[model samples]
Target: MKYVVVIGDGMVDLPLKELDGKTPLQQAKTPNMDFIAKNGSCGMLQTVPPGMAPGSDVANLSIMGYDPKKYYTGRGPLEAASIGAELSDDDVGFRCNFITEDEGRLDDFNAGHISTAEASQLIEALNQHFYRYGKFYLGTSYRHLFVYKKKDAATLESTPPHDVVGEPITEHLLKPENDPLAIKLNELMYKTSKILEKHPVNQKRLDKGKKLANMIWLWGQGTKPQMPPFVDTYGIKGATITGVDLIKGIGTYLGLTNVHVPGATGYYDTDYCGKVNFALEALQDHDLVFIHVEAPDEAGHAGDIQEKILAIERIDRRILGKLLEELPSLGDYAIAILPDHPTPIDVRTHTSDPIPYAMYSPGCESDKTEAYNESSVENSFKNSSKELMEGYKFLKFFIDYSQCKKA
Candidate 1:
């Protein structure tokens, strides 16, 4: 028996009036997702635990069966691992986003989705100036990273740039008084902004009438954390396929191989079929393969309803559709599909609401769900309580069930 988990990041959403009060999942044509719901048990899973932030760091950790309260440190350390930035015990990691600011207001969080090559040059310039206090490493596009040598920096409170888009930048500067290391971080950000504003990169962007990647926003700080490897926890080797560093970082620490798929950009333009091809090939050697798609989440953050719907349809057709058609040839397998959290279109951020999930196994009992969406799962739950279960709990159950069947 084999296992596959498909995570459509921030795929869940609230109902929209434009779609006749239907959520994107309901409005989108997701035949493959609907097929899973029809043949498998469906339920609402609370991926984000109580009192935890609804970021992918905590949510994906919980989805993988590790309790966030026990294992989660911060988002920075995870991304650090993905980019091969080794951190010492005393070092702290931070996610440094290259953003655009205008007239003291927060503009684009992604700086017009700046190209990695261009962002790399900007990060290199930042390293030349601030390499003594902390070092900057380019990851992807505006999603870069910084590692602070001081442990106290990990305690600093910084807001995610995405959460503060279109707001005043002054109101959201990092609070540094609480920690001396934070003071350094706050000071560095100001200095870096001044330097970046006049840099050649910003000048070029201005010439093009593009959003300038003028400032570095720091958030999601933490030291390296210790957690049991996934193989030890599940007794099955696994691989991960994702374009996002945070998810790939989690997989790296969990002893999972990261499958790099060309053109898998973690955006709407990502090559969806490439991810499916890599995942299928990975399954040939591993017992489990996890695939994460970030397009829906990005669309949600941009508050573009049509893009979100289109992303969902693409995942259904390109990723899951290909897997369902090919996996049967390999052997008996179970596929679990769910989002890490809800990036609602209206809110343009993650919500702590429970997300709907479906698990399809050969010859397994069905919940009679016809489509994969929030409303359909709610209706299915009303008919039977057997499908209702916690998100983290399902991970363990799925592993054990597959192990038993394999034996």
Candidate 2:
């Protein structure tokens, strides 16, 4: 049997008063997702484990069938793997984001969604000045990496920039303020601001009235992780299609092929159709293909209600709609749709909420869910015996649910 999982990253949201008190999922037209819910099963899955921060790295790891508590090191190491930045045992990889600091506040986490070409030049200047501390590796956009040789640096508590936008930068810098490593890293961040402030890239951005990537905010640090490959754990060869480096990094470590699609931008303009087309092509050789879209998540983070709704619709129409049409050619396929976690439009950050999911496989008994959305799944979940399943267990349940009917 073939398997496909479409992950609409941070697609779920709380009910917003502006959207007529309906969540984005409820407000958006998702007939394809609703079809799966109607024909298959619908319930909630706790993608982010209790007590863990609801970052994409943790949540997606859980969805990929690896318990985050057991396997998650940090977000940095994952992106490092995706960008081909090898981390040594003593090296602590930190997720370096080019952010805008205004009047000592964290003005913007993404530096106005700076272009990759502009970021590349900034990355080069950073490495030139900070080579003694660590080398910066360019990933994409404002997302980058810095590998510090000291393992102790991993213990420093650095806050995610996206989580604290408009907050005082000093209040959120590397914590336990007395630690030497924390002090050093925090000082490095301040120094970075000086270098970036005068750079030609920032000068051009200033001329254009764009947010300056004038400071590097470092967080999510960890050494390399030790885990079994995807095939060893699940006995299925899987591939991943995503624009985000973090997802690609997870796939890299799990022995899953990272299918590169030129139009997958990890932004609002990301090519939804191209991602599905690539996943379909990858399925020709892979047992399972995970199609992860980041646009919805980006909209959620930006708190753009219309954009989030648009992204959800695009996923339903362009990705899931197409996948439903084409998967039948492969025969006996199981298709599942769910988000990694809730990046509530109001909250504007990842939340540890149980995400709704719908899965369909020919011949399996359906729960008769009429729609795919937060409210629909919650109502269905109350009537079903399946409580909120753990994120890691969902993969096994999905595969077994499909295989049991064949047997």
Candidate 1 wrong stretches, greater than 4 Å? 176-178, 386-388, 401-407
- Model 2, residue pairs in steric clash: none
Residue-by-residue lDDT tens digits, candidate 2, 79-188: 99999999989999999999999999999999999999999999999999989999999999999999999999888898999999999999999989999999999999
lDDT of 1 by residue, 264-351 (tens): 8989999999999999999999989989999999999999999999999999999999999999999989998899999999999898
lDDT of 1 at 282: 95
Per-prediction TM-score? 0.96, 0.99
Scored by lDDT, model 1 comes in at 0.88
User: What is each predicted model's overall lDDT from 0 to 1?
Assistant: 0.88, 0.94
Clashing pairs in 1: none
